[model samples]
Target: MFSICLIGVIPLGTIVYILFLFFDNPSYQTAIHIFARKKCEQRANKNAPYIASYLSCFLYEVIKKNDIVDIPVSDTSINYSGYAIRKNSVIYRFITPVADMPDVDEYNLQKILQNTVIGQLNHYGITGLSSVYQDTTTIVPSVYIDRILYSEEKHLVAVDVLYICTSKDLLYYQNAVRESNNKNKAERTVYDDEV
Candidate 1:
């Protein structure tokens, strides 16, 4: 009798679970959407390095009206409000107020800018490219979007993206020199030194 009752309960539980899975469940839908967005971000990150080299080559001409003359470098921390523009092999960094997020079309434009920066760095013969999304906020920029495809339930926020481009060869050579001399390993830091 106990075994039969247990079997009956298992089927009932399975049936309920199936119903929840198949039915329109808001919580489940939200979870799925969040998971998908994360996965997409991960895939983008993985492909970033491979494309950075190609993108950096065209960054200067791609980013329009860049007149800044120096690369913004921070010895202590990353700069969030500034953008780095590459002209030929020289990179100019300038600090400005936050730029607004582009609309869906502008988002495409942003992708072009991103690809351009990555490619320009690669053209400099730098390797090991990485980009990180540091912050997302709902503060809208001055730019306008021409069309809206789908409305988001939550206000869409602009993201702060940080890109790192460095040379593995130079790093390895420096490390080897330090090791041969039996000196303490130098602390690795990102410095946007003037080119």
Candidate 2:
């Protein structure tokens, strides 16, 4: 009777958990994507200053690995510092700072950041993006805004960022997953042998 309950309950619980994740993950992912796109669109239309944070959240939700870092704009200009997608042409690099660059150009920067967001969405299989292209007159929505605040003690400027993708990045991620599985298998083998 004990064995029967253990066997029946364990598998049932595992199946339920798997099913929960399978059903819930897509909805959560879609919600984040929609939120990111909508927030970016609103930022573009209203010149809002929340794109970086929103994009960071979106990247974190989709990637499930990398932690998107917000680069201090004052440190660099012209360097791609938004959602580091790839680095070393192999491993993912979310953001790298650009230094001592020209003065921030809000309009052009907004266009570049918007394209970066759209490009990332496309990479993740969200295709045929229309929000950025809805109004031809606007070209692309702004994903970054220039906002400066001074408190007589410190000054701050919010700069836009860029995202890039390469085949090597994808390969690296696949390899990493394979390696992780191999490691887990090795550990399980050791445990079974000890038992």
Candidate 3:
């Protein structure tokens, strides 16, 4: 009897999980739309490295125009993967995988940005700008652009770029990071820097 009950519950649990995946939260969907426009851009036909450099420069301009401190650094790789600094400490990184997600469309990408990063930061009252790279495989393609908010102290201290991953996976990874950060906060006490 117990074994039969367990088997029945397994199917019921799976149904619930599937429903949650399909029925996304509305705020998250809206946020992705808001950021989508600025996140997709076309890349130039130069070598991958050159294209990457161009993106960094483009992102720098956006950051600077928004009054974010720019930390200059040498060029790294290209093709949707690179990093930049702000005020010498905060770092932002971007990456695109060789392959795309199975179910993701333009709409999904837009939703991810709006709901996940931009919406969350806006809630915290941090504002800044963003640039998007599209079809980086080709030179001279459409790029997405937008403005975002990043606080001096709380914005993107560090980021690890990922490619070809689902938006859900990315959010789950971020949630884990948030949880870890929360745990760390309790382990340390405040200290005066002057001493």
Candidate 4:
């Protein structure tokens, strides 16, 4: 009897979840969208490291133009946001570059930026599905994707990268370094041994 009940339960649960998205409230819809996208977010987190090295240089060119030069270091915690697109009835996944989640304990600049892309992709949907890369975009090299997935493909759409606001002992260290550089840049007149 229990086995017979289980078969109907799975489809019933899926129907209820889908109906929730049919709500009139926009915020409620978005919340369910996010909840559904959790696994995709985790997968994006896994691939952040592999993509970081390739993405860093390109990102910096745009990043510096909008703000005073901000150099990304090795590892940093960041976020993602974007839209999910669909073409026809098929949706392709932007799965992780690995079979398992990678440890992202180390914080760095590139990783943070990469994460923003990943997060953007995940936050936007359960899986990234777009025709952007297929639509006459220039082919770029991604050796990691080729090696792992056995093919090179991308569905990239540009998304903004944001840095996390941080407050810690590190702020003091960075501030000190900035002040020293500013002093060096100023025209210095030597005087006042005691005064």
Q: Which candidate's lDDT is highest? A: 2
Q: Candidate 2 residues 1-195, lDDT tens each?
A: 999999999999999998788758988879878898767554433421233444444433332322232323332222223332233221111332333332434343433444455555555522222223223222332122211112222232233232112234334434544665586677664456687
Q: Rank order by TM-score, top first?
A: 1, 3, 2, 4
In model 4, pairs of residues that clash are 73-109, 74-108, 75-107, 75-108, 76-107, 76-108, 80-119, 80-120, 81-120
| Candidate 3, 1-195: lDDT as tens digits | 999999999999999998787658777668776566334321111233443454455433333333222322223311244433222211235432222232333333333443443333334322222222223342211122222222344322122322212233234444544665686678777779845
Q: Which stretches of candidate 4 lie over 4 Å from their true place?
A: 1-28, 53-138, 141-195
Candidate 4 residue-wise lDDT, 97-127, digit = tens: 2233222321232334344444433444212
Query: Best-fitting candidate, measured by TM-score?
Result: 1
Could you report the Cα RMSD, in angstroms, for every candidate shown? Answer: 19.5, 23.0, 19.3, 19.5
Candidate-wise lDDT, in order: 0.36, 0.39, 0.37, 0.34
Candidate 1 RMSD to the real structure: 19.5
- TM-score per candidate: 0.26, 0.23, 0.24, 0.21
